[model samples]
Target chain A: MDSRRLFSGSFSLKNIHPSVLITAVFLVAYPSFATDFFIFQIGAYSLILGTIALSLMMLAGYGGMVSLAQLTVAGLAAYLMAILGDNSMGVMGLGWPWWLTVIVSVLGAALFSTFIGAVSVRTEGIYTIMITLAVAVAFFYFVRQNYVLFNGFTGFAGVEPPTLFGVYWRDPVPFYYLSLVVAVGFFAAVSYCARSTFGLGLQAIRDNPRRMRALGYNVTLHRIVAYFFSGIVAGVGGVLLVWFNGRVSPGTVGVDVAIDILVIAVVGGMRHPIGPFLGAIAFVLLENFAIDLIDRERFNMVIGAAFLLVVLFSPDGLLGLWNRVRDRLRFRGNAQLSAERVNKDDPASSGSLEKS
Target chain B: MRNFIERHTFWAIVLLLVVVLFLWMIFAVWPDWLVEAFGRKKTFVNTLLNGVTLGGLYFLVASGFTLIFGLMRNVNLAHGSMYLLGAYIGYEVADRTGNWFLGLAVAFLAVAISGVLLQVLIFRRMANDDLRQTLVTIGISIIAADAMLAIWTGTTYQFSPPDWLFGAADLPIISVIKSSGAAVYIKYPVFRLVVLAIAVAVGIGLWIFLNRTRIGMMIRAGVNDREMLAATGVNVQLVFVLVFAIGAGLAGFAGVIGGTALSVAPGEDIRYLLASLVVVIVGGLGSITGAAVGALIIGLAEQFGLAYFPTYGVVLTFLIMVVVLAVRPQGLMGGRG
Candidate 1:
């Protein structure tokens, strides 16, 4: 392996994809060109969702653990923020400083995630889904039932984002930028970690835990630690989410929202960090405009159908679909040329091709 | 039982003590102190009975799930939708014809046919991939949930049992002796008792079908090793469809029964699905007896928790699952595989 830093297997600045740079620039310049609705609802909202989905992607994609409690963990953070910070509900607010509240909330979520991981890591593969789902549902019900702590069904509303540096962060452009920073930070961290020793070992454990155990790795510990990291990512997203919504409720952590996170992560493709954002954008767009095509209540059906199609045809999601199309195009154009060269250039396609 | 006692005398003694205490609590009139400490004897007994009866409903739903999982390694997440669908169909039939039994029969047959369709069209295409099966089922659940909402709307529907099953039946258990020297017995809903009886009958029938019958042997063999069963010239695909049909039918049957006992609505699917998932997890997968035991434990825990601690009732069920996962990841009766 090369000593140089790699971003999604790229070794140098010149090796970076043009599309990635364009997307980055476009996201940065988005607030200036777009209206507040596009800036906040479409832009920031997608980024927040994408960040949460990215945490799930990191777990399911790299760590081989499909946890449905990512949203629950995010919800916990949001709830904590509402409790610790100013709230209009006259419930559990301690009026703590924003920085302190955010830090504590993130750590609390991470610890909670770690506990969930500890409980669920005992089971393998499919059972992981069942366990995490059970936990998510349990938390949702707990929050809904407990009035003394979680304010019961109504939850906390009027949770305002702090005014920092003489600017209100919750405003459209500012919130969009805040979400973008968090999103980009998490995206970079996940991508960088994918090549790091821990990430490689995590992937190794995912592929064959028994073999990794024989090789003297603490497979359970590694997976649990991965959950902690993913929790932090989700926790930040949760804080941003509460700020974005201006409230936190039991509905925020409901099973439907949890499933939506899974759908986003899956529909984006779980293979890479960027897949989550791609998926989140598509999901957000669909969710926003679904009313135009059909009744708002039937949006779930449309998304479910789309998800089924993607799962059936391309198990890897839209990112995988793109890769396949690109590979096919390259393969067709180079039929008379060296097929081996193309294969060497893209290992993902080569492995898929061989499997087929 | 003798072998178990011989192997674990301590556990046997503990079990005996618990049983004796339970029997004493039921048979003997609670002293004043006991009554004050534990609230009303009627409430206590009712909660226990409700828990056990509710367990019957859970068993009906979960047995099918474990059966499919045991045979196909597929977790049909859309199963809840099937339950809701059956309830709606059963509700329609019963309402239109004014025959509850006919409604139950129609719901079973209709859901079974749909199950057959699913087996042929979707599952047959991806026979080996469990993940894909799970994803497909999730997608199906989403679509089915929406479609059902579109058709039935979101109103809660309750089934009206016949007059005989409508009222309560007097139980032999003594609740209290009045000052006038009359013994008052506990009265419970007759329909709930009937549900319990039906569950017991189904459990025994399933056990007999699985253990005594020849096809049961084939199913057991297939659950252990599908390729080997196929190599032995068994019509594996036919067996798959048959099991799917039966399993799906059981869920539908339970839907009608449960709808009568409880109510049918949009989100009932998720509630029952969660129940089945937790029950199966605690009971051990691919085992009928495990489902029964798990359902009993979960049902009792849920009812007791609701009675004693209403706020954290869901947590009680969840804690059982977590504890089971921690202590025995394979579940209590799950094979060592």
Candidate 2:
């Protein structure tokens, strides 16, 4: 029950590395067998969602901050791209190149996120969630009405994907591959960051901000950096989303979708990198297949039920369930071997004890 | 002087910007008739009345939200669902009974029971964890929405008051303007008047309950420090159940009133939930006074924005929220711990 014992006992490589490798392999190979529509619709969409959820997981799991506005940050990036890109022809138009717009959008989202983080990181737990949620609501309304800048309720369309290697880039296969590459890159980067000193500092803050502050760590700065990192990941996902949908609407960043990202992160298991992908897969599959099985109108009922069940039974998520099963099997084998060793070491002593 | 300057700085800047923006907008949409309209005292009174009527409905919805937050710190994401449920149930009841009053009563009771059952069964178990509570409530909301969708489809449903309550009344002061070019018309709905009266009564009742009663005192205590209440041997779980139920019931009542004001639609549950959230955030969570103030601000802004600046109507609420949070993160009334 001691803190040191708990920390030592919780540490395990078998639960972490194998799962990550398996997930990476599955993700890399998923697009190969998927149909063109499936690749674009399910595969690409899942990756975009996974990436967003991963950002949330990084903040919530490591930094102990459950932000409900990650989607808003992503939405901001998308809105920025739509407003700043070459297609914008109305008032507030800035006919910037796609690359330049993309960079600006990402940076804008990061800066906005940093500002939000600065205000929110001072609060703990539920208050932080509410603050970010308020921000999301504010932004949703802002975009819905600001026609000059965000194209108002009827958001910008005709946002063509950037061409790469003579391909239209709108093709499902290519887009899927593009999403895969980006997701992989982000996954690697976030995983690397998680193992770094900065990540450790965030974890330390999560555990005991007061203690970490006493130890001379800039708690606020570290929290802000974490938010910036999370924003970057979400912003990239936003770019991919706009490209995938070929349009950006206010509904894309509404409270429901914001909450969905939290659900996906929680469902995937927030503790590890691969959890988001796993969660995304579960969500995408359920969304695609559940609607087919049930009436389309009642599909949400099914999803809601699944969400409640998952939260109540598996708080660590699907990944945690997998790890537990693996651990149990390993323990069983070890228990049998240890019993055999005991028998061999003292056969006479064991027989007498058994008779007694 | 330093404290005074700092305290007034944000508001002063906002006021200056608002005035400049207003003047610019007025100039851009310059109409010769504006001078006459602005000169009329009756028109000004009507506009103020419009704002008050709208504020009443907002207060009705937001009161429940603030109460739940104040009592249990658990954000009932599905509060809107209860509202939706109330409207739908009210509509169905009215259709069957052919009596609007009875239908309203049935809707209120139905929603109140649903709230109580949800608290006793689902929310009671999830009270310890906020995230889990949110997730589960979201699930419940989604399921409820889907259920409503499957049953009613995406079609909008309307509710009407009795035939006797459908006419407009002429006021003596405004009657003078009727003869002139400025006809200050006041078309009133009996349902709206009833809603306003009920909202005020409920507000007063809630104030008394929270301030006067033992259970209400327990709820207030629980809201401030739930752990401390638990340590005092009070059954915190029971208090939470009651609070959640009462909150849900309030939302349901608002739903019936709101449905009469607007049409009950499938996706509107989330929209109204967002609206209520804005009210709570702006007014400050867990404070009824905050909810009332937040609602009035939002309602007035929404009404005025839609009336004069339709393009900016949606952004107006958000702009208010952002400005409010920027200036007073605790909200206008300030949160209770």
Candidate 3:
């Protein structure tokens, strides 16, 4: 609300939002401070997943469309990249340039998602979830069986990151930076777009599409566009995911993985752009380290537990919890606290607190 | 012909075609390819039996989900967890006491009690909110699944039914096909037939209870308009709890039967859950008749797909789900919610 004072900060959390400064610091000098290769690699993978989850958040948060097919779209992008680009696997790799492959993959993903959106957009709530989930399941099975197009269950291997400017992009630091930059760029783009008129209209439509339709907005078209944008974001993430793993397989785009994407989005904050990233970091950390704590097969229990706890207790996710604590602290410490102020400023009073 | 046409409608026509194609595929097309492995007549009979039995299993699971959803509009993703739990309980009971029937009884009671607890503790607090209830159930399902895995391990397990009820029984089937008018004895699993009978009995009982009983009237009224029913001084919470318990009990019972027929493992929960979803979606949510038709179609499609197009075994069911959702989210049974 206070644009002038919003960004003004002298090493104080009170003045400037922490994300910008933290992001900038990570962007410029992440390699020097955190030189551990595996950490960066993990960060890169998390950022890719975070970006994918962020795309889910874009639809679920703003558009009120909870799609379980975001991962499928990402998988489609990755599959296209593998098919189009050079791969060691004995499949029909068109062997196109990486940039061209990226373009085609992202575009193809958008088209595929728009089609999915067209089919599912008519339904509301649980039906939409069911339709999207069914699509994900169908895609998973289709890829697993379609030998010519998807190379069957084995999938394509050796989808390494392309070298550019005489630099091997697959290196830990470089890959991390690439993923981080992409993730941050998309995150910023979403944040900015969410504040714009189109984004406001979308949020309004999400709340009451029928009302918006009565007001003369093309509800279905707006929904299709939302899916398209979400698809682009997911497509970028997919290309990154494939490059990061150096392979594409059915396991990567599995039903469990698709559900895990929802877990990540839900465990982050479905309402905030940054929520996915927060959830992703937590998820990636547990995925990497939690294996030491238990057998690999039971790790799902941990992830599921995390997902449940977040959804049950704090549906807004970790970010929501932080905001709640911060708000309480603000009230207690700022000396502007009063019963009347509480009544006036409480989000629940104004109906901003979404009843999860 | 007029009465048939009147009752059949467009869906009936489509249903007839599907049945014809299903029979035709097995009787005509399959003989050419699979005769070498599975004799044509045997394969046809086996696939039909498999589809019908699988339909019974799906009906048991989907009916409970339909009831819950119709009443509360809550999608209980944990329904499958209850199935897995029931299977494990049955396995343990049969292993200890060696009474399969007792194991089933105990499993049903235990799961029903747990379902009641789930309704009271979690679902009740959610204020009938879809997302909240869905999320909470997902959590409980996770916890239940993990607990089951921890206790029983990841290995698939099945409890043996009574020796008399188990194994194949030869039954004479008189076919009019090929104008033979001859009777052929087919060896079909007796246990499976029993399971189907049980499913039918449950379905009939559910229907009768819903239509003829006082509680059934309340349930129908409650499902139609929860607020109005509650405002009229009926105990809606009690109905919710009973429905949840019955649904959970049915799922648990189905688990035992399904486990006996096929086997229960870590992912069985999700598989049955997916089956129930397909059933409810295709059958039209909240409608028992829809659930039955949905289950039959899915069962037949699944079994047929597995036999013929092995690569895309479950794809047919998911395809049906997607198509139905696309064409009519209301489903074949015209479920209201």
Candidate 4:
């Protein structure tokens, strides 16, 4: 699942994989039969978080830059939407249409992420993590303090979705579908991009920056572009997130959420495009239902234990475990040998990070 | 612009200090655009002392963090969690027994044990995998923070020093020109001064241990080349284990001190974690000197910001980090990025 031929020319969805087909069918039918709790709590929240995690996965997985600021980007988008679009909070509402607000928000986040990447790209591994994290924490404090720009700690509270097509998009089914469409579109885009020439080149750089530079590629530019892509994806998630909750606040982009996104991506398996959504579904379910079994206050403990276990046993995440199980069920020795060979051959594909 | 500075390291470092000094003077002037409350000279002295004390606490925390990073290359994100753990432990102990020294010992020992477990159980397996180690530490931190909440609840807690150390001490920073005579005074918390003394002792002892001992040399070597150290017949695992525990234990120690100075609460773990991070970045990673210098800079900026610009206190710490990273990604003393 992690490996592909360097220059594969085949891109067809005609013969859809069973797993993909099954998931799509379930998502399409989810809103009709599911209860409001399941639709909003499980469906909408999971997809929104999944999309944000997916953005992180794209950068850390493909571009080999682990950033702890995707949530900041999303929060920024949410804040922009609240300010630029009409909202009940009555704090600097520009009364712009939702579509224009979204476009502007996403583009603005893209620019923001690109700038963040530019500042950080010169540093390797741990420095990137520290810089991005510092920036994110800084943004959180800035938002909490700057009342004029971010409405202070208590941010905009009413950010209802635009009623396009005479259907109040905040309705459970409509919102669920909206989240699904955006998530699926980004998932597909990331999947396709992973196979494209630019993606392969990006992966090559991730593996050996020196070699790629020798071969005449602007490694820094590629890394920045990857961050920008993730920024746009995260921005979309942010807009959808505000619509789902109908609010935006400093808490929305706090350090907890920032790390939560990282945990989701890591737990899902950053190697594949679908890993983040799966991770998000697991996370959302845990967040939503685990409180019944455990104390509500200790929820982070459960997530932390689960994250540690997942990382310890399978650094490739849940998908890696699934692949391992599948391989074991197949002609055991051959599958094991082939898997080992693939891992050995392409370190970047396996996400075995090597500091530049 | 950043590349130009990186290429000219000495000049850039000087330029950074000059800018910081200039900003300090400008802010000290209390221009009309700034807040209007801080005209008293005594207040500036109080703020400066607070900065030093605060910096001392940061050094206690970040020293361990940078040492672990230097030796094992593992980013212990749980360092702050350990701090919180220590604070809580000290609170419970001191609250029960009413003995400050006993509470300090227990806090250190308990956090040390957990640090050892963290090394042996989690970070050991991830060997040289910084990202995975980071993820594991994050998980550990989350678990610890939640567990603290479950036990301590959401309310903030504090462990005051012994009654003897509670009074304020007069620092002779300013002189009064009354008709009686000139008397110097800036009354400061005796407990804070005690904490400062302890922090200084730890810093000096740590510096000596690293530079004047065989084990310290081994650790320095390990940070530079773990493989080489292993190849030369050193038990690198033992070194890693020892360093991890020391780093974690230091954070725990800082926790109780910080708790007494400023109450420990639910979110203080992340707060200290972020503070130490800023300390390491500005000071440069791995070196004791770097950690000390960085902590003082952060402490001063933070205290001054809080006194003059309450809203922008935390923002100043982050701003320092960004400026440092832009000019020198390797940090003030970091030889390697």
Candidate 5:
């Protein structure tokens, strides 16, 4: 019945400790797997998606802004990299170095997100969703039609993944490990930020914007920073996605996929950092299997059904369910312990306690 | 007032138009030279026509978008999927009945039923929660789109109504200036004209419904204040369900018209969904007039951009959206909600 231990457990859940278990499991098991495609395609893809969803979770869960344009930012980065790099066939090709190209792409994504966030953050609730959705659509069509930069419907191709450390990084194993490292790093960064004063400030703002404004917290600045941070995660994921696929197209960053990220975040539970990974795993696995079993066209049906069911049954997502089960078990154990204590302290009181 | 004309905003637009006209004149007067300088003018015009037709279809889609957003205060992302559903239903009906009118009627009704079902089953449950409602509708949209794709096998289906309505028409309006040596030909599809008519009719009907009917009064009240309306014993839940159904029904009707005008294929739903969203955003959510105005502006932008700036045509709608949002966050009409 010690209040100190209860607080400690809750604090640990909010900190980087739980991630240690997840990271240990991944690192230990990943090397033993021999399938290159499994490591690179499935594992890498999930990590990349997880990173993108993590960014969304920060925005929606923390800032109360459910953006439908996060994927657009990621796509924009991928497209910018392809268009500005040496391999581009576009008219505005810069032929820049890979490092410079990646930096510019990420910056471009951040800037784009800032512009969207600036306008969108002004509104709250569904209006914000619509605004971001509009921006995403506009970007999608713009890329699909503009051949000079986006290369029209075909999009930019032959954008090679960078070779580093005398290794072909495009290989599934390397890419998987790369994604794993990046995901872990980004997860840690977000986890750290969430415990920081700024994260607490953002959460406070989300809870009551008027009150936060009264407290002299620059609400808009906090939101913009969150957006910039979210954009960075999405931008990184986009870079990895292009490298993994070896191509960038309008289809890669369309509205459907943008919504899919939101779905992943919500399904995994927006309450924790691990939620994105859980959601991403479930989404990617469901998508892969659904596509395999059903007609390719009907695969989205399964996803849609899952989305509806998850939202209706569990507003808190998978993490919420896990916490609920854990809480129930703990409550039962505490009850049994209390009964034993009662029996030892006051035997007569036990009969009354049992009746009660 | 005189100085206003010389401002950068005014001059910049004038300069743009001048440049565009200069380019047009160069292409028209120096055919062979212009062909060498730029791409072919005929091809450019054809692409422009394509853009216009595409924009027209988008207008239809966006019109429905504006209507739904204006009344319900619900951003139904599934509007696009409803559009796709309408197209598939129309295609199936047409294949079976061999009658375009019948197919359209059946498709419209089928889509309306789906819309009502959605309102009752899903959106009704999400009355107060906007985010959850959006998520759920998006889920429904995806499901509808996937189901359509599954049934249709994701293959592009061609739906030509009639021979006369297939391509552009040579009207008497063009014949009057035949001897003037001017390109006065305005080639347009009959189906597009039908779309225009339907849009106008629906617009009128919506206006009347809101202004004249008892149910419309209840809907307007609900839009203004759901609790107030419910307190007044207006059956707010029923009103919400009806509003959603009507919104979805309009989307479906737009889909049938759009499909006939354009090709119905996989991924078309998302494209139209985006377009419709833009329409509502620029037009201001929850205002029919705003949606119409937004649709027209977007339609014309797409048309002209495709005609002149073929490469940047798709970006035109988005650019307008950005500009509109930047300049007027409440949209042009300033919705009550």
Candidate 6:
């Protein structure tokens, strides 16, 4: 019976949430009914931003390191991609093959992120925000000022995605599917890792780094490695982002954009893997449509207010709100069953149940 | 000083040499070869003066940040918004009332009131949750930034200081000798010198406040251990509110002064915020002296870099930060960490 329960517990069809299934179906069929603008601008853009925010989520949620330089990492990849691959900037475009450029750019970003991690991990707790922020701002100013490598003020433009397998990757449908595939892949990867030994150790470290170190875990190395992995995620997102915009500019890696990535991750939820995507969808939609609903200038105020409310009321974000509401309904429906379920699920409470 | 030299013999020697060289650069008349090697004496002195004055402005902004962070453990990301709001408010008040001093007074009071409201409303509700507090501040900053933009378009604003504060004053430093062999002194902006004087005044004021006053002692104790301070019946919340008010007020005050020296524009908030962040990181969080040192180093690096290397100026400031972070992760004067 125990084996059977283990087999049917998580992966069973019935275990899948109805909402998740519906969203998956809708995403797959989105291009069929939606206009090109909606599919590309809203859907693909959200997925790209979500993937980037997910990297931040991985660090802040599980690793307890809230890096503002994640966007800077992504921007480095984007700039590298622009430099190595085709670009109309006539700057440093080496015109390497697209595949090679993507690989190198992602690795470069990971290495850079790892370096940032190594530097920041020397300090602890709240110092992470200040250190990473300094790095991000420094990179922004450096790129804007350095003309030889970064092309200075006017960044690279017209960096297009490669045509592969008889399909233009930048086309609305293809890009949407591309972004969706990458986003879902990362989402699943994060979910799986969250249960892995490494992730469990990370969470343990987050809860108590000194204790983890006392228990013989290399806390600093684990954190730096997490940064490397998150860098990969952010790098891929950056590649997709640059492709989405067909350009890479200093504005892409500016301080405001760096903070915006943090906002998206925090607003969505830092606890779950899906939170970034959910947050990204809301953000992208608000960005696109808020101008119509409110004054174009007031959009940041609206989003800021929304973000403030979320932080104040639901620290866990929309997902937390959903869980709270669901729990309330479940509690109202059958209080006894809910209490029994908690007793059954939680090992700490099982002792009382046994005594009873 | 002997203890420091014993502890960090190499650094102490380096510091001593740097001071000697700096004094020589400032007071010693540059020979023809020296001028040829390092460019004009006028440019070098001007760069040094600009760096110091800029450091003064940075100290004003960062001291408050370090104070608030040291006491409450809250990273007020909205601190920059307060600075910009102060600058804008000061500009308006000074322009309308034609009294720059009144503008400064009102800006400080107004921003201090807002800081109090933020403490009572937001920070108090979410005590002990640093990340959440930071997020809320970011949210507030976003809203505040947008609201300000809506009110004060994108135009850059500069403060017209009192007429007495206008024009450059001749410094004692000799810039060059004329063909007739007359020594020519270097001239610098009067407002910038006043700014530097005010910064030094605030620094001494803060030092005396922290060391000589009972309320300052309470703040210091609170920074070390809030729980213990509260347990001692010190009214911890009141201390936090007071520190936040002073910290926020200083930022606003700096905004008006800095705007007068430089220019107030849309992106000035982010610039000052970055400067404060870097200053605190290099100086050591929560230490006024650290903020001063860090600001001076950063300001000097930026100006010297700009004067010497046209393109890689930002990198010089960044390199100082990286080197400091690598050498002392706790910052130069940071202790409580």
TM-score of chain A of each: 0.94, 0.86, 0.90, 0.93, 0.87, 0.92
DockQ for every model comes to 0.59, 0.31, 0.39, 0.53, 0.36, 0.56
Q: Write the residue-wise lDDT of candidate 2 on B1-337 in tens digits.
A: 4674589998778867986875453333334475466534444445545666677887888898889878776777888888899889999988888888787788878888888887788767755677667667777887788788888888999887687665555543332344346845444555566666777898899999999999999988887788999999999888877777677777777887888777899877877787788888789888998888888788778777776676778668778877787678788886543
Please give, for residues B132-216, the per-residue lDDT of candidate 4 as tens digits.
Answer: 7887788888888888888888998767677888988776554233457665456788988887898999999999999899999
DockQ-best of 1 and 3? 1
Worst 10 residues of 1 chain A by lDDT: A347-356
A1-356 per-residue lDDT for model 4 (tens digits): 32243225453564456666787688899878999989988989999999999999998888888899999999999999999997787788898987899999999988888988987887877778877887888888889987786789899988988888999999888888899899989987887897788898888888788899999999989999898899999999999999988998889999988999998998998888788988999999999899899978778888988998887788888988886676676646687776776568545554644342
Of candidate 2 chain A, the 10-residue stretch with the lowest lDDT total is A347-356
Worst 10 residues of 1 chain B by lDDT: B127-136
Candidate 2: where are CA atoms >4 Å away?
A1-34, A86-94, A214-216, A335-356, B1-47, B171-190, B225-235, B335-337
| CAPRI level of candidate 5 | acceptable
When just chain B is superposed on the true chain B, each candidate scores a TM-score of: 0.98, 0.83, 0.89, 0.88, 0.80, 0.98
Best by TM-score: 1
Task: Give the backbone clash total of model 6.
Answer: 0
Which regions of candidate 3 are displaced past 4 Å? A1-19, A145-148, A151-153, A291-298, A335-356, B1-39, B174-185, B335-337
lDDT of 2 by residue, A302-345 (tens): 76777778877877788778756755776688977655554563
Write candidate 5's Cα lDDT for B147-208 as tens digits: 77667876888776867666766533321133557756545566666666677778788889
For DockQ, candidate 2 versus 3, the one ahead is 3
Q: 5 or 6: which has the higher TM-score? A: 6
Q: Going through the candidates in order, what is the number of backbone clashes in each?
A: 0, 0, 0, 0, 3, 0
Residue B317 displacement in candidate 2 (angstroms): 1.8
Question: lDDT tens string, model 6, A191-267?
Answer: 77776789889888887788999999999999999999999999999999999999988999998899889889888
Candidate 6 chain A TM is 0.92
Q: What TM-score would each prediction reach against the true structure?
A: 0.97, 0.84, 0.89, 0.91, 0.84, 0.95
Please tell me which model should have the higher lDDT, number 3 or number 5: 3
